[model samples]
Target chain A: MLGLNNRDTRFFLIVIALTLFTPFLLQPFPEGSAMAQFNAGYPDLMQRFAIYGIFAIGFNILLGLTGYLSFGHAAFLGVGSYSAVWMFKLLSLNVIPGIILAVIVSGIFALIIGYISLRRSGIYFSILTLAFAQMSFNLAYSVLTPITNGETGLQIRLNDPRILDGEGASQYTNLFGLDMSSSFKLAMGDYVFTFNAGYYFCAIIAIAAFYLSLRIFRSPFGLMLRAVKSNQHRMNYTGLNTRPYTLAAFVISGMYAGLAGGLLAAMDPLAGAERMQWTASGEVVLMTILGGTGTLMGPILGAGFIKYFENIFSKINDNILHAWFSALPDGLEGFLVTIIHPFVGKGWHLTLGLVFMLVVIFLPGGLVEGGQRIKTMFSRKKNSDAASDVKPAE
Target chain B: MDAILLQTLNGLDKGAAYALIALGLTLIFGTLGVVNFAHGALFMIGSFCAVTLQRLLSISYTTIDPEKTDFLGNPAKIETPYIEGWFGPEIGAAIIDWSVPLAIIFAIPIMVTLGFIMERGLIKHFYNRPHADQILVTFGLAIVLQEIIKYYFGANPIPTPAPTAFKGSLDIGVMIGFDPNAIIYPIWRLIYFVFSLIVIGGIFAFLRFTTFGMVVRAGMADRETVGLLGINIDKRFTIMFGIAAAVAGLAGVMYTPINSPNYEFGMEFLVLSFVVVVVGGMGSLPGAVMAGFLLGILGSFASMNEVKQIFPGIDQIIIYLVAIIILLVRPRGLMGRKGVMEE
Candidate 1:
């Protein structure tokens, strides 16, 4: 319970330990083991987990703190991704410049949307954001085809001239002297530990973003934002213009989304307009809610949980299920697997829907509240036992 | 001028769909104050109603015929349904030909029951929750419903054909004393337009004339006060929800011939319908209907090849562009009543 105050530091330690040692833990299993196949310890998926974590964290700031539920935040992420990819195409492959450009472009886009949408509050605001996001998605798919590459998506071409490196060109760019596509591997006995350079890069950025969020959470500005959420009328009556605070929060979250989007493109230099679709926006909302909306750690945990499930569950073919079930009785194992089959594999979404329903119904405050409850129960049990001993002494 | 008329006709056909779905959305929002995200899924299930009825009608017994060699070189003896036994061959053939239109009668009650179960089982529990939670739960329900439809229907689009009689297009240009092939319009699309008008009119007539309609409208205005009078406003609201579901179902049934019934059809138009509802103002029936037509027309105009040359991507964004402008100018919408979504 006391560690809750320094939960961020504790979480940081946990992340570092896991990232450093996961390879050792992952290596003992055979190369073709199911655990190996499902290993998120692989850099590509881990990078995605961190990037999406940042995106969800940004969404939580708006939905959790301000109580302004946005069904359209994916537009910013899409904009960021597109811009990042374009940067790679037109300029040097250095993700630093690409990421900066993405943030700026996405920020400006958010400014216009926030300015207009902030005029409405509550559900109207939600609808307004959704409408705008939908429009952006449509435009990207069609009219912006030349720019966004529509459904086919935009990708890097090796034929392009590289002014930064000159003459002979490369399809991909390096990240501040390190190759974006490179991996770092360590070996111990029969075990192999492969660490993705990009994963570490994203991990660093996520840590910095997390700290920034913590600062925002503790500041007076954050306090005002929460006050506005609780009672906007009271804040208005007190002579505070709640619009600016909300707008600021909207912009900040929008930039965070841009950062995440840039990281995605940096890792893989392809951007599709579908990334900006309303469904993508809704995903972050689900992630934020599934974790613990207002809690800082919830979004990251939620992002990891969702991405892990999406990757792991989607890969569970009939063969994989049968492998696990073979130890049981012939008829019984087949029956059990058949019942669970539709809820995984291509049907992984069914399981996701069930989890979301349970979370909404039972754990309204999400996993953070569940954690608190467990902590409270243990403390109460110890206190009761101490009281019993005191009564005997008396 | 000819192009304009043709586009308007095209717009009206599309508008008919927007209006029907929006009308249902408005009715539910008016009475229950619950934004059911699963409404689109209901519309989808309604379209599948035709597919189901068609399957039911296709229960023909096959017999091997040595004399007849079909594509597979098998015997071709097909037995028709009981309807064929009752009606003569010509009339029965025609009736079977128009089964999609006939499915409308079957869809209404089925869709209504589906709506009722959904409201009572899932939506009722979410009545006191925040709009976001209601949205999340219903969205989940929508995904589940769509997946179920996908499982049954598979991923491909299944073409539900119009009857042979209405298969061709009409040359309205010649009727208007212009060139013959200038303004060609499909006969079935015209039927869809007329059918939507009748359905819309019937709903308006019922709401305006019937005692039950009056009670529902009263409930929408103030449920607490209506309940205080011992009228059981919640029950009426539930009925209103059923009617809304039926309205969407009818739209889907008629819509089958226009485009094939596909599992994703519901989501395809869901956003556009929501835009229509917002631009028309939430919970306002006339507003929904009006905005639906207006946006549909405007959207069609924006999507015209000529229009695209000028603005590039106006078609993709036309509905949203209209929505944004409306929200900015009249925060309550063009016809939205005050205090509907303010709380």
Candidate 2:
């Protein structure tokens, strides 16, 4: 079972299968069709799905388990990205060293920030993290120009000293001579499935991270973290030091964010201070909350759902809307398009904000809880049906 | 000495805005026991009210002038604002020029109505919920409000200028027994500082003197007791919410001339104001005001060239850094009451 219970192992397998066949599953619509615009099987988006999947899973550990809502988690992600780009600058274009350094550096950042921020719980903790992140972001955009390249972001240069690579190497990020962007496109008539090196690399890491989260969810350490969330006073009375546990969760989640950032640079070797913005941190929070906090799969699902919606919603223009509703009567079609216009196009954030409010109000447990409720409803119906068949056996 | 005086003035100006927003936040928090993440949005809306009025006044109609030739040698189109046509051009021009100040009249009613609706419709239900739930719901609401503004305003900072008279710099240092032109400050910033003091003072006076204010203060201290006295405290809290919204709206109204109003400006101030509120001690009005000015001054001082030379980027982060240090030392903040979110 690979250290998982029966249900967990099954869930894990299903997730792995889904990730493996994502290129197929995501591109359900064939080419040269209107629905193909919604297809998210492309390399760039698939990489994001995996990368943000890692980010949300890590966030869930701290917020869902320890109940310490760190509003500056993006700072760690930014640090990881900066470190990764630095690795690409000084070292070789190999992703392994870059990703390793990213994790280590972000871990250090998390330790320092976590140690300071974890002193106060609740809203105080959230503000402290926010303040720290804003500081980093401002510094990165201004004072740290020597290191961060200011607003332009960090990128590769041909004249740079990459010590590991001999004479001439591909300037692009690579994994043992395999370029990150190198992808095999399998064309089956109307459908095309892309298999990118970066996506697979991220997918594998995301899977491992997801598995580790599952183990943590079931472990005694996770139990302690949950206890910290439930009642810290009781934990203190029980003579349990919740600080170390919370800190560990914070650092672990920080590392997850770091890994996600490193993977982002590995896919496309660039880093920007914008990654450290409070809004970016808020987005990850929205993902974790909108999925289902404390669930192994919920955070990942939330991340993917948001990314997908962001991609699809932002792409819809008046033309597309008109095309979709062209069959409707003229007035009705015009009315529908006008009503939906504000929620689509560049107004995707408004839709997202509204969704977050609705989810917080109606479905606090997120989509997972909704799924569970539907399941129960079906089971209750079956039970009622069975209860009405009493004369059949007689 | 001049440098110090100038920095102090700059700091006080910055603090004035912070204090106003923080005051509103504390008022709502103290009265309703709700952590309003949407308060910043209300401030942004208030700023936009200035922009809205400015745009409204400049609603123009074009006419082809027979005498004026176009660049293409045709008759030129002379665009005249509707206000210019209805009122005299001079009066209409003055009205447009003083849009920022004029926005106060427009913003007060709008912000108060929005506040009343917010309390009655959304926040009333969240009173007994966990603080986290309150935070999330408000955060969502803030996003929605901000996005709506962005949709209309196009994410750019609209430059709403101060009146023509106040646009010039004032050499106040000489009047205060300093060298001539030793410390020159903008008139609008000075006005903003004085305006904030007036608002702050008026609020304090109202809360201290008025019968309603006394009842509300009592309700803040002990809601159940006020309720037992048969004095419908919830309606009073809603009214307080409206007043707080008006205070924030007025702050935003005056602030447009100093800093061009943008959709994201609210978010920018939101964190800083929250810091001020926390540093002032949650639910403490005077504390919120005090912390706002103190941090604003400290932040200004941090941005000084001498300070920046030694601790580069200190200007950007000094307020937050000070907040962290204070929180660690005094977990309850500078003037925070005991047992008010002490945990």
The TM-scores of chain A alone, one per candidate, are: 0.91, 0.96
Predicted model with the maximum lDDT: 2
CA deviation > 4 Å runs, candidate 2: A384-394
Which pairs in model 2 have colliding backbones? none
Q: Each model's TM-score, in the order given? A: 0.93, 0.97
Give model 1's TM-score for chain A to 2 decimal places: 0.91
lDDT of 2 by residue, B237-313 (tens): 99999999888888888999888988888888888999999999989999999999999999888889999999989
Candidate 1 lDDT over A1-394, as tens digits, reads 2223565567656755754564454355555665666665677777888899889888888888898988889999999999988888777788888899988999999889999888888777888899888888888887788888888999888865545755544456577667777888776554566777787788788877876787788688989989988999999998878998999999999999999999999999989888888878878988888888888778877888889899878999888889899999999999989988888887877788778877887787777767766765776777966433331100
Model 1 alpha-carbon drift over 4 Å, by segment? A1-8, A15-30, A34-36, A167-170, A187-191, A384-394, B70-95, B175-179
TM-score of chain B taken alone, every candidate: 0.95, 0.98
The candidates' DockQ values read 0.61, 0.78
What would the per-residue lDDT of candidate 1 be over residues B139-169, giving only the tens digit for each residue?
Answer: 8777788777876787788788888999999
Residue A229 in candidate 1, Cα distance off native in Å: 1.0
